[model samples]
Target: MASSRRRPPVEAPIAALRDALARIDANGPVLVAFSGGLDSTVLLHAAADVLGAGEAGSEVESRRSLLAIHVDHGLQAPSADWARHCVGQSDTLGVDCRVVRLEGAPQRGESVESWAREARYAAFAGIAEEVGAAALLTAHHADDQIETFLLRLVRGAGLDGLVSIEPDTMRGGLRVLRPFLGLPRSALERWARSRGLAWIEDPSNRDERLLRNAVRRQLVPVLDRVLPALRQRLPQTLAALREERDRLRELDRRRLETVTEPSRSAPGRAAALSLCAWRRLPAASRAGVLRQWLALHGARMPSRARLAEMLRQLDAPAADGLEIRHDGFVLRRYRGQAMLLPAAERSCEGAASGFCLPLRWVGERRVEVPELAGVLTIERIGQVERVEPVGPVKPVGSPGRPGLAERWLQAPDLELRARSGGERLRMHPGGPHRSLKKLYQERGVPSWARRALPVLWAHGRPVWAAGIGCDADCIVSKGVRYALDWQPLRRSRPASAPERSQH
Candidate 1:
C-alpha cells in the first residue's frame, strides 16, 4: 500500500535510429543511395532527422542538404511514374532529389534481377565518388540478412558465405554500412505505415516464379505455421551461428599468418602455403584456412571441388608443378612453389642474357639487359613495342622483389640483359629459392637477367620455362582477351648462341 512502482520506459524507432547514428564511428557528410523505396525513404527520413538534431542549423537548410537520389531501373512497367512519385515525396519531405537513369542491356544468361542489383550499386558507387562521401548506408533489414543466410546454407557455402552480410565493410575504398540488420522487415513496414507512408510495390516481388518469393510466400509461412515462435528465435539463432563463425575466422587468421607469405611472387603466392602445414590440419580447419587465405588476397573462396584439388596438390610432393584452377584462374606450382600469375607472364627475353643494343634515339651508348637479373637499361628505349608478359614469368630474387619474380613487370624488355652476380631467383615452392638469379649474376651474364632462361624459338616465343627447374610450357595464351605479346626490343643474339659467361 505504501510503495509505488514506476513503469518501464517505452522503446521507439526514434531510439533505434539514434543508436544507429551513434554507431557511425566517424563524423560524416555521408551520402545515402536513397532509392525512395520504403527502406531507403525511411533511412533518408531518419538521417535527416538525426542531422538536424545534431547540427546548428535551420530545419529547412538541414533537410535540404540531405541527398535523396532516386534511380530509375527502367525494368518495371511504371518506373517513370514511380520516379515522379519519389520526386514529389522528396519535395514534400523538404529533401533534395536527384534522378539517375541506369542503362545497360540486361546481360544474357543472367537474371535481370541480378543485373539490376549490380547496376544499382554501380550507379551508387559512381555518385558517391562524385559527392566525396566516405560511406554509403543501406537499409538491409534483419529479414534480408536472414534470407541471404538461408540462401547460402541451401547453396552449400562455407561459413564465410554463411556469415551472410555484415554490419559494415570497406568496398572499393568506400565504406558501406547496413544499420537495420537487427530490425525485421515487418518492423520497417509497420514504422512506415504508422506514419502514413506508402511504398511502391514492384510486381516482380509478387512473381511466384522467383525462388526468394516462393521462400517468402510459401516456405516461410509454412514454417511459421508449424512453429509460431520461429521468427522470434531466428535473430538469436543467427547470432549464435555468427559467433561460431567468428571463432572459426580467428582460427583461420592464425593459420594464414603462419603459412601465408608476407611478400610473394606471382608463383610463390600459391607455393608460400606449405603442404605439410595444410595436411597437418583437420579437414574442417583446412577449408577454414583456405577460405581465410583467399579472402585476404581479394580472391573468392574456392568451391568444394577446387578446395579438394588444392588438398590433392598439397599431398603431392613440392617438386611436381601441380596446378589447380577455379573461378577462371589457374593455380600452378613450379620447383616446389605455386604461382598465380595470369596465364600470360610467359614470354622469351627480347635478346640473350647479356645482349648490348643501342637506344637509337638516345645516341650510341649500349643498353645492357642482364641475363638472369631484372631488366637493367643504362639507356632508355622509347620506341620499343610493349609485351604484357603473362603466366609465370617474373623478376625473381631482386632486392625489392624476392619470391616475387613475376610481380608487376614494369618496363618489360626495354633493353634487358643477364646482369651478373646481382640477381636472385624468387623461386617457387620456397619463398625465395636462393641465388638462382644470383647464379646468373655471378656468371657475369648481361645487364638484366632471369633465373632460368626458357627455350625461345627463332620467333622469340618461349616454348619452355627456365628448363633449369621450371618450365614456361604451362604459361601461355588466355581464353577470353587477346593474348599479350612480349613488348618491344629486337633480339641481337642467335637462338643457340650462348654469351660467354660462367657462374
Candidate 2:
C-alpha cells in the first residue's frame, strides 16, 4: 500500500536552543535580554517553552523560573511603544518582564550605536543584579559574529580579536549566555514565523550611517552573494583562531614567567623583565609577549602602529633608556631591564617645580613621599641593639645591600630629598666617591626615572640612595641595621590627563 507520507518540517532553531539549554543546565533563574527584535523574540519564546514545559509532562515539578528584560535606549521616537510590546509578549508567555529606560543621549564624539550597545549591556547587568538572575541570555547569532570578525579584522585586530563571539562569558558580574551563536538569523526567523510570534522591527537596523549597520546592509549581502559557503566555513576558521589564541596565551604565560621578574624596588606589585631576554625571543612571538605583559600590568591593547613602534625601539640594541608611555603606565628600559611603572600624576611643570621638597623621616617603617611618587620602606633587621660594629666594615659587594646602623638613627637626622647636583656616593668600601650623576649614568638608570629616585640625606650629607646602595661611610657591618628600599607607588592617570602619543 503506497500511502501518502509527508516529511515533518525541520525545526532546527528550537532543537538547537533546547540542546544548548540542556548543555548549560543553569541552576537558578534565567533572564533573557529581550529586545522585541526577531532574534531575541525567538530566543525568549524557546526559553519559555523549554523551561516552562516540565520533564515527563509534570510542569509543576520540572519547570524552571524564567524572566525577560527590555532596555529602551530611547534613541528613536517609537522606543516606548517597543518597550510596551516587549512587556506584552512577556505577559503572554507567562514570564516576568522588566523594562529599563536609558535617560541620556550618547556622549560627544561617541557613535550612537556604540552608546546604545553600552547602555543596553549596563541595563542588562543592573537588572540581572536586581532580580538575582543566575544567567543573562542574549540573542547574538552567527551573523553578528561574522560582522564582528570582519570589523575587527579591518581594524587591524590580531588573532585574539578575530574570534569575536563566544557561547558564554562573564560581563559585569553577569553570566551572559549566547545560545544562538551557532544558529543563523534565517533559522530564527523561520522559528518565529512557525510559532506565529510577533516582533518589533527596529528601523535603525537598516540605517547605514552606523558602521555595523553599513556592514550588515552592504558588505554582508555582497559576501553572501559572492561566497555562499562563507557562513558554513567561517566558524571553522574562527575555531582555528580560537585554538591558536589559547595555545599562544599558555605559551606567553610560560615565556613571560621565564623572562620576567618582580621589580626589586616594588616587591609586591610591579613588573620588570630582562630586556636582553625579551630581545632573544623570536621576532614573531615578541608582540604577543609584549601584549600579554602589558595586559598583566592593567594596560589596554595598543594600536598596531603603536605596538610596531614599541617593538622597533625595543629591538634596537643601542636604544638605551627608552620610555614608551601608554594608558596610564610607562614602560621604561634601563640597566638591561624593562619596568612598567604607573604614570606620574604630577604635571610636567608641577613636577619640575615642586619635586625637590625635603622630607623628614622620623624612623617610620613606611614613608610615603608623594613628591617622589613612591614610598620609602625602612626595615630594621637583626637582634643586636649595640651602637658599635660587631666586625670591621667590609667592602660592599655588587650584590649585597648595605644597611644603616640603628644607633646612628637614634636621634634620626634622616631627610629624604631629590638630587641637588654635585652629590657624590662611595658605593664600595675603598672605591673612589663618584658624582651621583656619573653613578646614575654608569648604572644605566634612565633620565626620566632618575628625577624620582630620592636620596636619603642625613646630617647634610648623602647617606643612601633609592637605587644606588648605601654610602660606604654609613655602612653598618653589624647590629640592628635598617634596610632602606624605595618602591614606586601605583597612581592612576586622571581622566582629564592626556596620554603621551606613541610615535
Best by TM-score: 2
What are the per-residue Cα lDDT tens digits for candidate 2 across 10-90? 467666666556655547778888999999998888787677632244223235688888988877899899999999999
lDDT for 99 in candidate 2 is 90
Model 1, position 25, has a per-residue lDDT of 59
Quote the lDDT for 297 in model 2: 71
Backbone clash count, each prediction separately: 61, 0
Q: Once all C-alphas are superposed, what RMSD does model 1 give against the true structure?
A: 14.0
For lDDT, the strongest prediction is 2
Off by over 4 Å in 1: 1-12, 53-66, 69-74, 77-88, 91-119, 122-130, 169-173, 262-271, 318-329, 342-503
Task: For candidate 2, list the clashing residue pairs, or say none.
Answer: none
Error of 2 at 170 (Å): 5.1
* Model 1 C-alpha lDDT versus the unseen true structure: 0.52
